[model samples]
Every structure is written in structure tokens, then in C-alpha cells.
Target chain A: DAGITQSPRHKVTETGTPVTLRCHQTENHRYMYWYRQDPGHGLRLIHYSYGVKDTDKGEVSDGYSVSRSKTEDFLLTLESATSSQTSVYFCAIMGGAGLAGGNAYEQYFGPGTRLTVT
Target chain B: TQLLEQSPQFLSIQEGENLTVYCNSSSVFSSLQWYRQEPGEGPVLLVTVVTGGEVKKLKRLTFQFGDARKDSSLHITAAQPGDTGLYLCAGAPPGSARQLTFGSGTQLTVLP
Candidate 1:
């Protein structure tokens, strides 16, 4: 298990409210990713950060945004929460960017945060 | 879009039974990884196969990457209740190492 933790293990909010999920890692990994897991959809990437202030959108980045101001924290924000945004959000870290051998690209995930929009 | 399609969306079996879950894709991948996720928890890395036609085993679980590098399979022999969880397969494309295209996943329940 990696030293990764997601704040707010569970949360419930209204549809129009704004929500932010936080991911903190103690490993100081180079790559950090945010993903959502829903039934029949598996895990879909929302955003990822390669370094401080360097982030990119992913396959399911329509309504989500991310920021990485520091090395240890990656934040995912939902500007206005929607029922469709309810899902288990996960944070993961990879030591190498597919450069290191011996499964260095393999990701280590946090426990996950469950969000519900009513 | 590059997609990894997993079969047997839902599975239920008694302990000691044997089962296989598959992940297929049309695009070749640079590497393939399998993960097992428990309820309320993140997916944990089970194994990664980078070489085509590679086979790796971990105790009762056996994983194989297709020779084409476009598909993979996971077989569990004499399943136990501890195996109950969601099994996801993700493929890494060449060049970019940003995000992984994950399969729909298979929810497996092993009843004791």
C-alpha cells in the first residue's frame, strides 16, 4: 500500500453545490492521477498531473477540473455538482512515467472517496 | 477511441470454483495491467504484463497477455471468498504515459 490518502471518505451534497476532493500523497511521486469508478464504467480518468502546475485533461474531463500546486497534493473540483457526478473517486501515483522498469509504471491507489449528489 | 472491453459483467460462484475473466481490445497496447478493487476502496494492482504472450502467476491466480498484445485474461483456480471484488483491466498505449484506458470491469462474488 502506498502512502496516499483521500479526504472525506464519504460525502453527500446537493446537485447545484460545488465540491472539491483532495488527494494527498507522501511518496512524492512524479505522476498523480484522478479517476472515477462507476458501475458498468469501471475507472475513468478525469485529470492527471505530471508535475507542479502541470496538469492535463483525460477521457472524462467534461465537468471536472484538477490542480496540483504542490508536489504532495492534487485536487479535483466539481464546479457545480450534478447527480451524474456521483461516483467513487480515486487517486493514484506512479513513480515513473513508463520509463523505469520492474513495474515502475504500475499505479498505487488511495482508499477512494465516495460522493453522492442529491 | 481505444477501449478495453471486459466480459462477464457480473459473476457469482461458490468457493472452490474456477472462473476466468477476459479483457479484449482492438488496439495493441504497450502494456496491460490487472487490478482488484474492494468495496469502498481503490483498485489494487494485481499484475502487469508488458510482453506479448506472457504468463504470470500469483498463487491461485493466473494471468495471460495475448500474443497480439490486444487482449488478456485472468484465471483463478479454486476461488475463495476473499476474491470477491471488482476486477478491472487497463491498457497503456505507446508514447504517452498519462492515462490508461480501462475496461468496463467484471464484478465477481465468491460465496463461501
Candidate 2:
């Protein structure tokens, strides 16, 4: 909620379709992350970007991809969405220097985007 | 994969009662963080505890990192209706300061 906004707050999509979620941050944080929250899973990281175009997979990277073309925008793409992917997606940005004495570990999360697949 | 497990998946307590939620793991972590999420909203950071056996408090909520750095606990005193929400614990594994492993979380409902 700290200067972070996610687009398409709620979406209902059918199976076998492609879906993309967008995360925009006004703060120029160097690190960005994508996570999914389900009923039994608190929050699982899908992917993360240390900088523009520098991305890496997270614990639950399968069936998902991410890209960061600009510093302020990070996008998560679900190729051929499945019912298992239906969950609340959240985007987070790592706080930069001067925040909490430059620890850079605290994450600020976006409002979240809920995707329902049938 | 390192896993953080939380206890009491669901809790319903009366106002003015005290409760404690736990987050345990077999893997050691460099630091641990606590967060609370409300309905239809993103999780908000509550506290971060570093160092073995470290303790931090925020008003009525007290958080303690385990001596082995593999577990943590959150204790709340005189709970109120406003405390109803999902509490999550996340740990930062050593050598990766940028990443975190989260627990399933404990859903708390404090009835007035």
C-alpha cells in the first residue's frame, strides 16, 4: 500500500487463457516481487526483479513468468491459466536506503489483484 | 525448500483475553518478520526480530525470535475486536537478504 498499485483488481477468467497482472510503484525501489496468496498458503513468491530486466524465479515460479521493462513497472504473466492459479496476487517493493537504516529487507505490498479461474 | 509452519490455523477468542500464535521452522533464519492482513487488503508489516532470542513489542503485541533462530512467537494481551485478522510470519534465510519464506498463517477472530 505504499505507493504501489496493481491493475485489474478483480478478474474472472476461464481456463486455458492468458492473463497478465501489472504492478506500478511511484517509489523508485530497486527490488520488486510477485506473490500469490491462497487459502492454505500465506504468500508464495512467484518471481522477483532486482532491477530492470534482471529477474529471477521464486519458490513457486512454475506456470508463471515475469518481466520488468521499467523501474516503476513489474508485470506477472500466467501463460495458459489453470484453475490452480486462481488466487490473490500481490506485488511488493523492497524499501530502499534510508528506510529502517538501509536494511532494504522490509517489503511494502500493493493492494492486490484477485483472479478467479473456472 | 525451507518451510515455516504456523500453529492454530484458526482462533476465536473473546475480548480482553490473551492469545499467542506460533511460527516454527526446522531451518534457521537470519531474521523474521510478522505481518497482519485484513479482509480485501494487502499484508501490513508489524515487526521484525533479528538475532537469536530477540524480543520486540508493539503496544499490546509482543514478538520473540527463537534462540535457535528457527522459530518465533507473537503474544497479544487484552485482545479486542479490532485484532481480528490473518497473522503471517515470514523468515529471511541466511545469505539471501532479498528473499523470504512465509508460513501459512493463523486466522484470528476476536469476538467482542
Candidate 3:
């Protein structure tokens, strides 16, 4: 979807282990976001990046950290994975201009990465 | 409590039947977006409504944004088997980052 690629499409990890998910975009979009999807929760934003090396926490940022050293890549890291973090992770890139045209913005999603923790 | 709550969490209807899903929120949003997601895939953007009381149509699907900017609805006419999927509604509040708060979503099954 929209030239976005997420690595490790499916992964099974143990609790307390460190895991990292990668999102790569070819569109050169200025904004990038990481979200998690569960059964009851539709999609919760974990973190977002407005530009390279500039990151901010989202509504559900606890226990997760993100880094964006390059414009085309955004990485989400689970410092210590937990069973509660087992869910489908999606990467999205925001399109359109700056805040002036924010109303016209649209988010394009990646295929998604499924992580299972035991 | 969810910022945006979607009604009829699960819906099943016969082919050719009509149905509507509602999403309500207490907070006023600057814009609302509709998305359809299939199994093993991320949600795809269907439409985005900005102006209050705005109505947009994409073929058989009709989407409306509430005048108060706190609610929205999606209506499908003459549903078909291919319409089976999860529908999600997301809202963008008036802010700088332009982040979105999503609804729990409505799962629909159009049985033939």
C-alpha cells in the first residue's frame, strides 16, 4: 500500500525480549506514524515523526520507543516486549502539505507486521 | 472510553440489503475519514469529509459528516458479498501534528 514496506511481516517473540520493527517509505512523505491494532482497539498511535530525528509520543507510547534517523525510514522498538504488546503493527505515511492544508491530508498505510509474544 | 465509538460492532445482511453504520464522538473534529480493511491487510482510505454537514458518495457507498463535527455515518446500498470487511472511522482534531483518533470499527458481512 502506497510504496510503504514493513520488515518482519510476522514474528513470534518471547516476553522481555527486545524487538524492532522497520518501516520504509519511498514516497518521501514528511510525516510518519506507527500504530498498533488489537481485537477491541481499532488502531492506537504509538509514536510519530514529523521529520528525520524528530519524534514524538502518541496516545499509547508507553513501553515503546521510536527512532527516525532518515527521512525514508522510521523504526519502532519495544524495549522489553510484553504479552500485551502482541498485536498487528502498521506503519502509515501522511500525505499533503503542512498544517495549513492539514484538512486535505490523508494517511497511506503499509501492509502491516504481526507480532506475537508468548 | 473510546474517543470515537462506532455502533453495530458487528453487522450481517443479505445481498441487496441496505445498511448504515454510525460513529459518534463527544469531541469536535476538524475532519473525518472512512476506511475499509480486509483480512491480512491494512485499512484503505475510502473517503475524507472535512466540511460539517458534508455528504460524499463513492458509488453505492454514501458518507456523511455531522453538522456538529462530532459524528459521522456510512451507508451502503444493495450490499454484495464483496462488501464484507471491517469499516473504521477516524477523526482529526484541530491541531498542528494532524494526528488521528480512530473508532473501534464496524465489522460487516454481506451474505449472498
Pairs that clash in candidate 2: A1-A109
Error of 2 at A58 (Å): 0.8
Task: List fnat, each candidate.
Answer: 0.67, 0.59, 0.61
Against the reference, the lDDT scores of all candidates come to 0.90, 0.92, 0.92
Highest DockQ among the candidates is held by which one? 1
Q: Give the TM-score of candidate 2.
A: 0.96
What TM-score fits each model? 0.95, 0.96, 0.96
Candidate 1 lDDT tens digits, B39-107: 878889898888889899999999999999999999999999999999999988876544688999999
Question: How many angstroms is residue A46 displaced in model 1 relative to the true structure, after the best TM-score fit?
Answer: 0.5
Best to worst by lDDT, what's the order? Answer: 2, 3, 1
Arrange candidates, best DockQ first.
1, 2, 3
Angstrom error of the Cα, residue A7, model 2: value is: 0.7
Cα lDDT of model 2 by residue, B66-110, tens digit: 999999999999999999999999988888868989999999999
lDDT (Cα, tens digit) per residue for candidate 3, span A45-70: 99999999999999899999999999
Q: What TM-score should be assigned to candidate 1?
A: 0.95
Q: For each candidate, report its DockQ versus the true two-chain complex.
A: 0.62, 0.61, 0.60
Q: How far does residue B18 in candidate 3 sit from its true spot (Å)? A: 0.2
Clashes of 2: 1
Candidate 2, residue B92: Cα displacement in angstroms equals 0.2
